[model samples]
Target: MKKRSFADLFFLLFVVYIVLPVVATMLYAFAGKWNKTILPEGWTLKWLATLFQDTAFIQAFGRSVLLSGGAVIIALLAIVPAIFVIVLYFPKYEKWIQAAVVMVYSFPGVILAVGLIRVYSQFGVPMIVVVLGAYVIGILPYIYQGTRNSLRNVDARQLLDAAQLLGASKMQAFRKVLLPTVYPGLFAGALLSFSVLFGEFVLINLVVGSRFETVQIYLMKKLSTSGHIASAVVFIYIVLMGILTFIIAKLTKQAKGATNV
Candidate 1:
């Protein structure tokens, strides 16, 4: 009974620790005035309204979506098939793929950005394109893990062999059998990658700067001007992340259900 009481108290403290800041930020975003009080003096939506009316903010949000979506699409198109081939036919090479995924993390964002600028700037290549390419490769670990786990959970080899023995081509078997079975996990990975890239700042800031202002850069620029507006931006960002997390959870549950069947 004493241990149970301690556990409950610990859980309450943990919840407060995690939730207090978010609640405060949300209040500040909508609060007309909040100073030295437990609650705001009054509440208003003026900050959020102001944010929505700003063309620069809208553009930044759009750019973030485009960059993140583009990266995920490129990853899906390239990585999915490569992983399928590796897992299905060339299983011995999977170790090399794992090594490459681990190597992605060896270079910090600053170093990677500097290296990219040195290599790509000399050729006059647009930094946005370079960043896009880097984003695709950066997400390999998520895509690889999600896809590999999905395939492993489903006895992919037997499914593929059965499809092929039934007079289906290897490509056909992959498309009709393997893809449906694994799409939920693939989509969950894509969502996770999108969320990560959407909030990325350091590489994009160093690589392209204001030439391509993403949501994070925009938020950074707004920080000095108004606290309320910054809080509003953060609120919106948190909402987006929450939605993506919910969807990813649903897809993961579905993937597990499919695998179990």
Candidate 2:
């Protein structure tokens, strides 16, 4: 009983530690004013209203969606096939990919941004595109891990063989059979990538600042002006991520179910 009580107390503290900040932030977002109190003095939606009505916020939100979505799509188109081929065919090359992912993690965003600027500034390539390219690369590990895990759960070689035995060409077998089989699981990776890229600030800020106003940049600018508005942005961002997390959970379950079948 003593051990059980101690464990329960620890778990309770852990949950409080994680949830209290979120609850406080949510309260702050909706708060009319909070001063010298444990709870908000009053509640209102003006902060959220202000956030949505502001053209800059709306634009930032849209650009964030576009940048994150575009990066994820490009990674999917360019990286997914390469990953499939690597895992299913040239798995010996997987170690090289692992090394690259490790290197990507080791490099700080500031270094990557400076390197990008120095390398691409001479070529007249748009910095936004460069940032987009880097975003795709930044997310390589997430996509690769998600796709790799999905592929591991699946007997992709057997699926390819079975498809080929049914008169499908190698290309057709890969495209129609193996790809769809692992797509749901792998798609979770894209969502994770999007979430990560959506919150990214350093690369985009250094690459293209006022020109491309992503949500994070907007939030950064707002932090000095109004706490409520900033909190509102954070609240909405949390909601958006919560939705994506829920979708990821669903996709993962669906992937597992399909695999079992």
Instruction: Give the whole-model CA lDDT for all candidates, comma-separated.
Output: 0.95, 0.93
- Mind giving the per-residue lDDT tens digits that candidate 1 earns over 1-261? 999999999999999999999998888999987788889899899999999999999999999999999999999999888998998889999999999899998989999999999999999998999999999999999999989989988999999999999999988998999899999998999999999999999999999999999999999999999989999999999999999999999999999999896
- What's the lDDT of the predicted structure labeled candidate 1? 0.95
Question: What's model 1's lDDT at 18?
Answer: 99
**How many backbone clashes does every candidate have?**
0, 0
Error of 1 at 19 (Å): 2.4
TM-score list, all predictions: 0.95, 0.95
Question: How many steric overlaps does candidate 1 have?
Answer: 0
As for candidate 1, its clashing pairs are: none
lDDT of 2 by residue, 88-158 (tens): 88989999999988988999999999999999999999999999999999999999999998998889988
